[model samples]
Target: MNERVLTPRNRGFLFLDSHPAGCRQLVADMWEACPAPAVPPAGDRPVALVIGSSAGYGLAATLAGLKRAGVRGIGVSFEKGPTARRTATAGWYRTAATADIARAAGRDLVLLNGDAFSDAMKDQVADLVERRFGGRLDHLVYSVAAPRRTDPDTGAVHASVLKPIGRTNRTKTLVFDEEGAPEVREVETAPAEGDDVEQTVAVMGGTDWERWIDHLAGRGLLADGFSTAALSYIGSSLTAAIYRQGTIGAAKAHLEATARVLDERLGRTVGGRAVTSVNGAAVTQSSTAIPGIALYTGLLRGVLGDGLVPPVHQLAALWDQLTGAAPLDLDADGRIRLDGFELADDVQAAVAERWENARTATVADLADLDWFRDEVRRLHGFSVPGIDYTAPVATDVPWPGHTL
Candidate 1:
């Protein structure tokens, strides 16, 4: 038996456990939030499809479907299984763990690992739902985060790049090294050029989301009066140039636009509802990969502290609201604003003040750097309980009710 304690090897932290115990407090709170509603929704044992349902918001939403609404869920994602050389991606562990929880609660969870942007995956999902889930899925959750995508229609490949859309934006970024010290690194991002917005929109935009919904509708897979939502984000003005007002922002703008079109189409076609929920930003697998996000999240924590909500908490809350008696309110553009607290006037003012004071010498001091770092590790099943780090982890554990 090889003894090992996984440690941060670069910006990509690699420590993990096979059987991870997520935050005890979070698990407790989620149990409380998971409702046994007497008055179920309009459907029978609600059926749901969560695209990209492996990590971050997607994982949270999948949990909500099973634990909160008692919905039978089919989760689709592009995740890898563990190999002899390395542990599987956090998304893989998360999917298997979530399935275990769901099955224990007497709910059903089917996981499909594949390229969601591919037409072949879409066809497989439609066929599976038709054969197994009664050909009617009432909820569609779109929460994909990938660096590149293939256009299912045209076969054109688009890669998403993280670069400022205008004049260079310089700032201090948070980076961790092998020594486990969170250090501030200087970074200068140049303006995007040569069809950056087009390329980014092609990859991260709502095209694939629409294609999924449309193909499902054509196949009669979308149940009448069904609801669909895609997770989105809008944070402090400090990051607007690099985030909200940049290439990614352009892609999100297109997403919001597509939601409007889908909203009307669904409403007219099947009395269905479509929305884009602008969720609060948190440290996740993708957030670490994006330029300038770690600094912003760290600074955000300095101001928001516990006020900021993680995705698991956020998803549970949203599900409670959606299933409760009240109707959902939409902004002028017909988008749900889940990023309310994150965009609050007080929070924004505090983040701005902190951003102004942040520097290489004082960034760690100005922000909740420790929480930011730990949360990133937690996303990958590190800092979890009930694990013997000295023993070799079983990377190829099979999911409950699944043959792998």
Candidate 2:
């Protein structure tokens, strides 16, 4: 077998020669690291449909469902491909690896390589549900995080921007690749208009979640006792001026509202329910790209890592809630605030105290704040145990449902 070294900077390598066996082995390793939950044989294996299943929280959720729920089949939708340089998106490698693992475990994993935002993609998903699982999906996860989405009804395309309101807010940030050093800076932002906020809401918010339900219900693909959920986050109040209180916040607000409508609609189907898992801050590609979030996440990670509440732990908790293993509390707006639990009164109070009073606060302090930074690194497929980093890796890889 050809060998290659995979690094944190390079992220992933794509092998030209399909190493089906090797891929299966790697999948087995990942599966062993995180075993699925056991289910009674008499209980029907739940069918899970995961959109944006390529990476980040979506991938974690998919793995959790596979291990914990004994999910027999999984349908994943992601839009990614090999770059001209022959490097696959991290999602592609993950999908390929996951497929091999599922096949070995006697599970059916169907991947759809298409735009989840388009009507055609919706139709394709419905068709897959009809043909593959006899028209019923027990759980649906809406995890797509796109900056822009075209309006299906209006035939208009909208773009999302991250910016602060009025005056430019300067803050300190952490450079993870730079040994966790603190750097002070001013936030550069794009000019925003009322329409910008509305467009962002329409694109990133809950309309697609509702549409997914509407399509599934219309096609009789939603099984009785079904549940659906979308993930959202309110990172930190410091960044909230640009994030939670800005265009993205508007989108999240819309998303939270849409969940209620979906809950009522799905309630009629199978006592089906709609929920939004407000996730904690982590170092995702989406999260990292946000202007002020890196610093915020870094600080939170440091704080949480010091035996404080971590996002992955919160993710595990969210999974428990979804599996009916635990009860969920919601804010007045009817959104399940996983992050709220992470940022509980005491935790937030401590962080606020540090932010207000820490003199000469340095990068070391931030990195050592909590275990969150380490968890964030792990979330991006880094810093995992027992993986040989020196081994040569392939640059050409294929996910099961991708057709070039």
- Give one digit per residue, the lDDT tens place, for model 1 in 1-404: 33234543333444543323343223434455555445654556888899988777887888777766767868998876666656566677677777667777887678888899988989988988898888998888899988999877677889987777877877667777666666677678888899888999988889999999988988988887888888888777877877888888888988888888999999999898888988998887777776678888998888888888767667765665555434787888887777887888888888888777777678878899878776776676655445444544545655445431
Query: Where is the poorest 10-residue window by lDDT in model 1?
Result: 17-26
Clashing pairs in 1: none
Residue lDDT tens for model 2, 143-249: 87887888888888988777555545455444433554344345566546668878888788998888888888888888887888899887667777788877788
What 10-residue stretch in candidate 2 is worst by lDDT? Answer: 11-20
Model 2, runs deviating above 4 Å: 1-42, 165-168, 176-182, 188-191, 306-316, 356-361, 369-384, 401-404
- The C-alpha RMSD in Å for every predicted model, in order, reads 3.0, 4.5
TM-score of each: 0.90, 0.83
lDDT of each: 0.76, 0.66
